[model samples]
Target: MENMIKKIVDADNEAKAMEESALKEKEELAKKIDEETQKIYDSYMKDALETVKRNDSLEEKKAEKLWEEIQNKQKSAHIKLQSDYEQNCDKWVDAIVSRTLDTNS
Candidate 1:
């Protein structure tokens, strides 16, 4: 009877050890999963940030090009206006003088 009791006690201790080992394995697996999930999230954020920067650069270039075109158009219009004023100044002065003299007469 004593021998049988000793065998039962040994079996119970072996079972407890197995349970502890399984628990430790489960905890390690959970930690590994969390680490892998964090890595994936970090990678995604990095890629997203790079894409936003690239898009912003493209948009800035487009805005600069549009601004340059507008400046060129304004410069052209100013030049044309100056040329027209120079060409018409003498004729306009003569007409105004004639009209004033005729009105007085």
Candidate 2:
């Protein structure tokens, strides 16, 4: 009967040890999985950020080119208006002078 009791106690100890080892293995696997997941997330985020940067640069270039074209058109229009005003102003002055002289006579 005493030997039987010893065997039972030893069996209980072995079961407890096995449970502890399995818990440790589970914890290690969880840690490894978390690390791997974090790496994947970081990589994806980096890629996304790079894409956004590339898109922004492309948009900026397009905007800059468009703005330059608009400015050039406005400058051409302004020059044309200035030229037209200069050419017509003398005619207007001469007409006014002639009318004044006729009225005075």
Candidate 3:
């Protein structure tokens, strides 16, 4: 009976030691996983910021080009209006002068 008690106690001690070791290993693994997750989150944020900056730059370029096109169209319209007025001025003057002379006679 004495030897049997000793054997049982020894087994229990060994089992407790193993449980403690497993608990320590679990804590270490959790710590490592937390660190790695933080790294991944930081990397994702950096990449997202860079992408937003690039998109903003592209939008600015597009807006500038659109503004330039609008200015060019306005200049062309102004030139055309001036050309049409000049082309019709002579005809308008001749008709007015002939109508006045016929009315006077």
What TM-score, over all chains together, does every model reach?
A: 0.78, 0.79, 0.68
- The numbered model that scores best in TM-score is 2
> What overall lDDT goes with each candidate model?
0.98, 0.98, 0.97
Which model is ahead, 1 or 3, in terms of lDDT? 1
| lDDT minimum window of 10 residues, candidate 2 | 84-93
Please tell me which model should have the higher TM-score, number 2 or number 3: 2
lDDT score, residue 81, model 1? 90
Residues 1-105 of candidate 3 have per-residue lDDT tens digits of: 999999999999999999999999999999999999999999999999999999999999999999999999999999998898799889889999999999999
TM-score of 1: 0.78
Poorly placed runs, candidate 1 (over 4 Å): 92-105
Q: What are the RMSD figures for all models against the true structure?
A: 2.9, 3.2, 4.4
Question: Model 1: per-residue lDDT, tens digit, 22-47?
Answer: 99999999999999999999999999
lDDT of 2 by residue, 5-87 (tens): 99999999999999999999999999999999999999999999999999999999999999999999999999999999899
TM-score of 2: 0.79
Which pairs of residues collide in candidate 3? none
Off by over 4 Å in 3: 86-105
